[model samples]
Target: MSFRSRGPRTVPLKSAEEVDAIVRKIRDDQTRPENYRERSLKLHGWICAKCGREFELSNLHLLTVHHKDGNHNYNPPDGSNWENLCVYCHDDEHSRTILADYLAGKDKKS
Candidate 1:
């Protein structure tokens, strides 16, 4: 008698805590890249992108270091097109897709 069985050639598993920790580390690195904060502030002229008005460094609360091409890791490649979006605009952009889906679902339910 001959038998053949096939399963995944390779499978990797990590505990939930390990996965969470890895994700948290990645997010932390992205949000606080080395020296990115200081360089970006100067590059953006210390102004709110949406308002186009100057603000003190302290007023730069909750500012998002926006990635113009939607590639957060791409690092702008150059300083030209990168922008500093305030929290309001940043959150708006980030939530657009989720908001659309939510609205559509609500509409269907109602």
Candidate 2:
């Protein structure tokens, strides 16, 4: 009827090894340069490849990185696979692909 009478008991804590592993994973992820958006912006300049729109720090959030080959995971360190696009152009780029697939009957493949 003392402290043991509390509603729900506390869950068991993680072991030291488990905690260390989690910390190491977080550190590794933070240090990794997998953010292709930043690299693309640096390599291609702050302009939209298709629409010729430019961006400044105030409107930089509208800039997006696009993969030329349509694969998001195929980022190249040399920036060969990346293009900086404004949000509108990026949406249009993807929309064309969707429209083409629909017209070509490729959408039914799945």
Best by TM-score: 2
Off by over 4 Å in 1: 1-34, 100-110
lDDT of 1 by residue, 1-110 (tens): 99888865886889999999999999999987556556687777777688666667678676767766777666653555468877787777778856887877863654
In the order shown, what is each candidate's alpha-carbon RMSD?
A: 14.6, 5.0
The candidate scoring highest on lDDT is 2
- Which ten-residue region of model 1 has the weakest summed lDDT? 72-81
- Count clashing residue pairs per candidate: 0, 0
Residue-level lDDT of model 2, residues 1-110, one tens digit each, is 55655688889999999999999999999999858898999899999999999899999999999899989989879999999999999999999999998999999956
Q: Supply the TM-score for candidate 2.
A: 0.70
TM-score of each: 0.49, 0.70
